[model samples]
Target: MHFSSETRRDDGVVERDFTIGEIPGVLWTPEAAPTPVPLVLLGHPGGLRTMRPRLAARARSATRDGLAAATIELPGSGERPRGAKVDAVRAELRQALQTGEPVTPEIVDRLVLPLVEQAVPEWQTCLDALLELPEIGGPVGLSGGVISIGVRLAVVEPRIAAAVLFAGSFVPRVVLEEARRVTVPVHVLLQWDDEGNDRQVALDLFDALGSPEKSLYANLGGHTGVPAFAGEEAARFLARHLR
Candidate 1:
């Protein structure tokens, strides 16, 4: 991992922007923290530029609780080149929405699955670099999501002890099957009336999770309607498991 810049926040947190080969990312650590603090990996909702404020807030919250936090730019996002596959997928997704067609499993598989596949490796690579840092320790946690990558990681990554999933995205049938194997503690958040999402699908996805310690937080309003307190609740959940 090659860090390009490091910033010290007024709140006594240190933020470092880095790149591991083609992947770009940011890591945050509390100032004067002891070595080997617990770490949390944050997943964004696609656009890194727009997502930074929210990501920073969550990182700060984790730091306050003595946990290090980090996020990697998803494939084909940020300064990375928008490859043909991603462009085609974006166009298809937009067309499906514009034509008022529901995003079916087939559609999600074709348009979103590839991105999910690409993202998992990037996140794994980020985790490899993060865990190597002297300031980060074991019992990693995952927070935020569009759903797919979180489910994939939770099922396959043993280092992740807990997850806080933002489940407002479509889930392919294959992903649902894989979700049945995710046994880590998970806290799933759903915006009850999100216009852009299928509420039944979100509920069904939550139901399919095989974790014995899964909890659901469903609230009213659209995608952005997640109340401030919901984040507090998620922080508590991660703290319980990670700390």
Candidate 2:
């Protein structure tokens, strides 16, 4: 990982822009931390530029808790090259949602499964690099982003001590199948009134998880309407596990 730029914020959070291979990413660390700190991988729905503000906010929050945070562009997101096949699949999924049709497992699998396959390794690899930084040490946590990716990482990435999964997107069949193997503590945030999500499936996904220490925070809101306190609670959950 090569950090191309660095800036120290007024709030004492050090922000750096980086690239791992062709993947663009950013890392945030507390400027005056006395000791080495934990790390949190910030997950998103694939648009780094559009999502920067929120990602930065979460990173700053993590830094406030003496933990570093970082995130990279997902496989076809931001300036990364995207394929026609994924674009076509996305269009089909949008059309189905618009037409009020049930999103078939085939559609979800075609769109998200490959993303999970590609992203999980990138995260693991990124963790390898980010942990190399002297300021970020030891355990890691995952926050937000695609729920399926979070579930898969919590299952496969042994370094992930805890996770906060936002159930605002579709949980592919494969993700549900793998959920039972995720043993790390998980805090799932479900927006009960999200227009684009199936509430029942989100609940089922929560029920399917195998984590002995897991909590579901469901509130009446849309996809982007997660209450501020809900976020604080999720951060506390990660802090508890990582500490």
Candidate 3:
């Protein structure tokens, strides 16, 4: 909950760097909002520093839409300590990717399970801290990836009113099972041609989601080539729920 720096962007979004214990995070709010505003929790695949520009852009979009946005670094990513064991698993996954080796279920289990277990609680903790701020007092919505962590949060975090999930990440089968417990409205964005993602897994996971209001948006592109209209639709989805 301690902010290290604050900067007001040209577009009138106020950005702040913060830390809750060991987890580093960022929060963005409308520069002139007077009342409490809805909050959007921006999730990413980790590496907060590397991801900040894109994260901030999303935050600015939220603020422009009269919502607040925030994100925390996931376990074993960014500046936090990952220890030897987690580092070893990360190394294994990277090596497999570089060699064009199929990422086995075992390797995915090793790489993703620990992250879902640890990051979900950290997000909840960050939410607890962010809500204490006077400027952010409305409903919470989670928007972004890793899809596994988003699924867990949608299931367990009662405070989250909605979620906008980006498909095409390493989702373990266990998480797909957990998705059935998620009853809140969910909008999933799937990139049909993402080179690094498994299309079948994304489709299966989308089908596994138990939300009666869920919608899957499959676009033709690589990981970073999401069409602009796709993002606008996801924003609209959040606006509908949080409002």
Candidate 4:
């Protein structure tokens, strides 16, 4: 929660870059917000630096809606060095894509499970620090993903009131089982023709969610072909639960 720099945006949102121990993160707060406003925890798709614009835009959207937003660099992303596990996973994924072979379940497990294990605790810790801030309050929401991490957080983090999950990633069986434990409200987005994802897996994972209140919005396109309106729809979903 130690901030190194702060910038004020034209939209009346203040962005701060910070570090909690070795983890780097950013927080965005709307100017003149009331004490203890709702908070949204964002998850990124790739390297945090590359995802900065998208994440910052999401923060601004949350801020404009009178909520605070925060996100952390996931393990082996951003400034963190890639450990052997992540390196192996990336190599395996690349090879599978290059060879036009469907990644085996065992390979998917190896690729995602360790990252899920490491990321969930880190997100919980980030949530702990975020809630401690005087300007943030209860009923947190989680948005974005590497899907498995979002599923795990929704299952274990009681503070998270809702989640907006992006369904463009694989789901290991163990993670699918854990998804059955999630009880928070969820809004899931699926790019129906995502080149790298298993469409059936995404559908099955959605089916596995234990949440009584969950909606799926599936569109016909590749991973990056999500329509603008879909994002707006997801934002509205978060607003409904968080605001």
List, residue by residue over 1-243, the lDDT tens digit for candidate 2: 898999999999999999999999999999998878999999999999999999998887788888899999999888999978889999999999899898898999999888889999999999999988888896899999999999999888889899999985577887899999999989999998988888988998989999998899999989899998999999898888886
Q: Better model by TM-score, 1 or 2?
A: 2
**Best of the two (1, 2) by lDDT:** 2
Worst 10 residues of 2 by lDDT: 167-176
Q: What is the TM-score of each candidate against the true structure?
A: 0.97, 0.98, 0.96, 0.97
Candidate 4 wrongly placed segments (more than 4 Å):
none
Cα lDDT tens digits, model 1, 1-243, are: 999999998999999999999888889999988668999999987777789999999998899999999998888887878889779877888899999987777888887788888898889989998899889998899998668999999988899999999986577678889999999999999999988888888888899899999999988878988898998999999988998
- Whichever of 3 and 4 has more lDDT, that candidate is 3
* Candidates ranked by lDDT: 2, 3, 1, 4
**Where does model 3 exceed 4 Å of error?**
none
Candidate 2 TM-score to native: 0.98
Residue by residue across 116-230, what tens digits does model 4's lDDT show? Answer: 8999999998889989988888789999869999998888888889999999557777988998899999999999999888888889889989999999999999987879899
Task: List clashing residue pairs in candidate 1.
Answer: none
- Number of clashes in every candidate structure? 0, 0, 0, 0
How many residue pairs of model 4 clash at the backbone?
0
Show the colliding residue pairs in model 2: none
Whole-model lDDT for model 2 versus the true structure?
A: 0.91
